[model samples]
Target chain A: MLLQFIIGLVFGLGLIVSGMSNPAKVLNFLDFAAIRSGTWDASLAFVMAGAIAVTFTGFKLVLRRPQPLFGEKFHLPTREDIDTRVIAGPAIFGIGWGLSGFCPGPAITALGFGTAAAVIFVAAMLAGMWLARFIANRPSMSGIVTPADRVGA
Target chain B: MPATSFTPVASAAGGALIGLAAVLLMALKGRIAGVSGIASRLLPPYEDREFAGRLAFVAGLVAAPGLVWLVSGRLPEQTIEAGMPVLVVGGLLVGFGSVWGNGCTSGHGVCGLSRLSVRSLVATVTFMATAALTVFIVRHWG
Candidate 1:
């Protein structure tokens, strides 16, 4: 738990330092068509590149150790196929992210800034998560079910 | 929104720190540094593995800004230009869609992709492309 807490702290601090908790910067980064207006903000692309480069090297080194530093096995995602659930879900998620210039990690960290928008956004987000549980439980939508289903339902 | 306002060097430095955090989580806890997944697992019916870990992680996230304030002597800027209704709808979509998708930017974009997961690659592309399209529509066409 202490380990997780420290990592989250580092992650959150990284977010603020990267200017990610700033919605205005995020919005400006997504303004792809801004080339015409000479206002394109490409800083985030650099951000992702830096992150991916480091993680790619670090994860590879760690995975080769046979087991994690603290666990018996490395718990990793195994699914490889890209189904509708994968595409559709993130597509919806993207729309929401673009509309509000917030994603889960940054949004949660932003709560500490004590902005009313942050509070409302977090509250509504929780409500959405609650609602999704009900939606995911319905057997009507086929293809694949929740993690619970995969665990043997 | 000017190009002059962008801070690539600082952004990259921050990104490296984030990557370090993700890598550390995976190496030490053997868990993905997925914010939405961790947060969701902590919610009601919280019959989750690493309950303490989840709670502690979230607490750390909530505490980060305060730490920054102490060091930097100012709170980080959190500008939300969107109105109440947009935030509401956006929050709903993000919260629900992340769960349904089984991941969000951190989960899919950072960790999953780094793990060489094809599904994460696809999801990341989908969300990023969709985000770009939405921005074009709202900022340009709207």
Candidate 2:
């Protein structure tokens, strides 16, 4: 638990230092107008590049181990299917991300600062999460099922 | 929006830190550092023995800015152009979509890409494309 907290702290620090926590900075990067205007902030690209490089190397090293140091198994995603939900879900998320320039990590990190916007957004996000599960778990909505059908019955 | 300065050094350093965090989480806990997944799992119908760890992780996330403030003597700059209504709607979409999609930037963009997952690649591209388009429409046309 202490380790998880420390990792989360580091993750939040990265969000802050990378300026991903700043909605304005993110918006500026997303705004194509800035590109035409010669004002595009490309910091996000650099951030992702740096992060991916480290994680790529790190994963190669870690996956060599049969199991995690503290856990019995590596709880990585096993799903390989390219389903509709994968495509449509991210598309909708993209629209929201572009609209507000706030993703889950930054919003939660910013919540530490006690900002009204962060508070409101985080609350709404949690509510949305619950609602999604509720809808997905609904037997009537047979087509839309939770990733794990074990949520409730 | 006006011109904004790029912070290559800080961005890269910060990103590396994020990657390190993800790596550590995987190495120790054997779990993906998907913020949304870690957080949302703390909610209903998702029962696990790691509940305490998840809560502590989120608590740490919620405490990070304060740590920064203590060290830097200033709060990090965070601007939200979206009004309350927009924020609410956007939050809803982000929550529902990320949950449904099974990942977000950190998960799909960083960790998934690092692991060379085709599904994650598709997701990252799709989200980036739509996000760029959405921004173009909102900023230029809307």
Candidate 3:
């Protein structure tokens, strides 16, 4: 638990230092106006790229070891099917990202930075998660549990 | 000029860095390096094993920028236009959507798509579509 909190803290702090926690920069990047004005805020892309690179290399190394740092085996996704939930979920996420300029990572990071708005965003985000659960549980929905369900809950 | 503006090289470098990080985390840690899952663990109910890896991953994220600053001479700039209310609401909606979607952009778009998961493709499409609609409604209708 401590490890997770520390990791989250570092992640959030990184967002703040990288200017990712700032919604204006994110919005400008999305709208392309910043690029037009020659004041682009491409840090989000950079941060993401850096993160991806680390993940790629890190996963390769760990996979060879036959076990994760804290687990008996590496947990990877096995399913490859697409469905309605997948389509609807991403579309909603993208729209929110484009509209608010504050995706989950930076938003939480912003919360750590003590932004009132960030706090509100996190709250709403949690609510959204619960809402998703509620909606999924509704009858006739035929909810399909993914790999995420297998993870320790 | 302020230290927050983006340069072409920095942008490209950043993207490359993220790609590299993604690959590295997978190789070294044998994990997907999804921020949502990592951040989610930070909440009250946490898992021990996931907690450590999450912290290290996040640390690397924060430290990379400082490292870049030392190598390069510039830092990215930020500007916020929408009021707090809009940002807050939008963020909340995204959180909800991510939970519903079972992943965020980094999870599905980067990792899942790379693995060619059809579910990720669907999720990515959904996220983008909803975003486009939201922007339209907020910018024009609302």
Candidate 4:
């Protein structure tokens, strides 16, 4: 438990230092108008690049082990087929990200600031999550695997 | 106007830290370190045996600003441009969409892409495209 907490702390620190925790900075990166006007911030691209570079190489080395140190097996995602939910869900998520420049990690991490806006966003986010589960639990939606029922779980 | 600070070094360092965190999680727990997965699983009908760990992870994340303040002598500046209504709507969309999509920027963009998952690649591209388009419409055409 402590290990996971430390890992999350590290992740949160990364979000802050990378400027992902700052919605205004994130918006500036997303704003294409800034590109033409010479105000665009491309730092987020570098953040992703650096993160992917390290993880890509790290995973290659780490997954070679028979099992994780503490667990019996790696519970990686089992599903591979590209489905409509995959497309539509991310598309909708993208719109929200563009709208507010705040994604889940940063939004949660930003709660450290104790801002009312962050609190409100998080509360609404939880509600939305509950709503998604509610929709998927309807009798007609049975057998359809929403994210609530991911293969790993 | 909010100024965009070009912080390549700090951003890269931060990214590396995040990658390190992901690596540690996989090495230790065999988990994906997906924030949405971790966070959402904590909600109702809670069945995860690892609930305590997940809650601790979130607590640590929420406490990060305090860490920064301790080291830097002040909280980092954050500007939220979206008002209450927009924040609420956008928050709901983000929460719902991430749950419906199965991941978010951290999961799909960082960890999933690292594992070379085609599904994550598609999700990443789709979201990036739609996000860019949304920004265009909101900032330029709105």
Candidate 5:
């Protein structure tokens, strides 16, 4: 628990330092034309590249071992198929991200900043999660990912 | 185009920190540090050995800024351009889409891609393109 807490703390601090908690910064990052026009902002490129670089190296170094250093097994994603779930979910999520300029992690971490906007966004996010759970029950698009999904999930 | 009004150094540093956190969680707990997955699993419906760690992680995430303020004497600046209605719709889309996609930037973008998962690659590319298009439409055309 302590380990996880420390990780979370570091991640949160990282968000702050990365300027991700600042929605204006994020909003500008999504503005492609502004990015091309050199007017708005485009810092997320660095963020993504840096994060991916580190994780790419770390995972390469660690995955070769029989298992994780502290745990019995590694819990990576299991599903590989690019089904409807893969396509539609992220498309919708992308639209939401563009609209609010906040994704899950930044939105959650921003709550620590005590913005009423963050508070409302978080509440609606949770509600939306619950609504997904309810929607996942229908038989047609069965096995859909949602409020209850995870693990190679 | 010359960069303006964006701090690449800060973003890279923070991204590095986030990557380190993901590595730590995976190496220590044998789990992917997907925020939505971890946060959702903390709710009542899911119960397991992982619950305590998940809760603690989320608590720490939610408190880092507060701690920074207590120590550094300043809260990080934040701005959400979207109004309440827009935020609500956006939040719902994020919640539902992320859950439906089975991961967000953290899960698929960071963790899955690190492992070189093809599904993650597809998901990431798809979302990024859609996000860019969405932003273009909303900001420019709309």
Candidate 6:
């Protein structure tokens, strides 16, 4: 638990430091109208790059080990086929991101940074989650257990 | 124009960082580093064994920014034009979407996609498309 918290703290702090908590920065990036506007901030890419670099290296190192820090073994997924769901969801997310300039990660981080607006966003996000459950329960959707259903419990 | 904005670089970096975080979490904690999973477990049914790890993950997310601030001396600024109602509504929709989709962009788009999970691919597509449609309607119609 302590380790997890520490990890989360580091993650959050990284967001803040990287300027991800600021919606304006994100908005600028999405603001296509202001082409070349100094306001456009794409710092997220760098942050992501650093993370990816580390991750690629880390995974290689860890793969040699017998097990991980907490669990019995690495739980890497082994499926690689794109489908309708993949196409649709990413498109939707991109649209939302372009429009709102706030993706889920930074939005949550924004909440901790004291953005009242973030509070509303978080609430709505939760509501959306609940709505998924309702939708999943529909007769037509019986066999489909949305990703939301598989997250925690 | 401060003559020192690294927006382009930052965006790429941020994306990579997200990817890295996912990898590390999986390697170090043997976890998927899914935000929804971590946050969801923070409250509710009370599973002690899982609680600590989830809590820690959330903590890292919240605290990473502060740590950066300590060294960089520059904090990102935020601006929201959609107002409170819209943000709330949008967020709720997204939260629901996250649940229904089984994961958010980070979880599915980055992590799941990298691992090549068919489910993740589908979920990511759904999330992206919905968000795009919503944005178009809101921007053009609303």
Chain B superposition TM-score per model: 0.92, 0.96, 0.79, 0.96, 0.90, 0.84
- Worst-scoring 10-residue span by lDDT in model 5 chain A: A144-153
Assess each prediction's global lDDT (C-alpha) against the native.
Answer: 0.82, 0.85, 0.58, 0.85, 0.80, 0.59
After the best TM-score superposition of candidate 2, give how far the Cα of residue A10 lies from its true spot, in angstroms.
0.3
Which pairs clash (backbone N, Cα, C closer than 3 Å) in model 1? none
Q: Taking the candidates in order, what DockQ does each have?
A: 0.64, 0.65, 0.33, 0.75, 0.62, 0.42
* Ranked by DockQ, top first: 4, 2, 1, 5, 6, 3
Model 6 scores a TM of 0.75
Tell me the tens digit of each residue's lDDT in model 2 across B1-142: 5456899999999999999998999899888888877777788876567788888878888889999999999998877889999999989988988877888898888999999999889999988888889889988884
Candidate 1, after superposition: displacement of residue B121 in Å?
A: 1.2
User: Per-residue CA lDDT of candidate 2, range A1-153, in tens?
Assistant: 899999999999999999999988888888866777788999999889989999999999999999989998888788788888789878988888998899889989989988899899998888877877677667887765436311100
Residues B1-142, candidate 1, lDDT per residue (tens digit)? Answer: 3233778998999889889998998788778888877877766655545788888888888889999999999997767889999999999999988877878888888887887888889989988988888877887783
TM-scores for candidates 1 onward, in order: 0.93, 0.95, 0.70, 0.96, 0.91, 0.75
Model 1 chain A scores worst on lDDT over the 10 consecutive residues at A144-153
Mind giving the per-residue lDDT tens digits that candidate 5 earns over B1-142?
A: 1233778998999999999988888777778888877765654455466788888888878989998898889987777779999999999998888877777888989888888888888878878888888878987884
Identify the candidate with maximal DockQ: 4
What's candidate 3's DockQ score? 0.33
Candidate 5 has a DockQ of 0.62
lDDT per residue as tens, model 3, B1-142 = 2325554444445444444545544544456646665555545444354555665555554444344456576443444455767766676668767766678867776666666567877876677556655544654463
Real interface contacts reproduced by model 4, as a fraction: 0.74
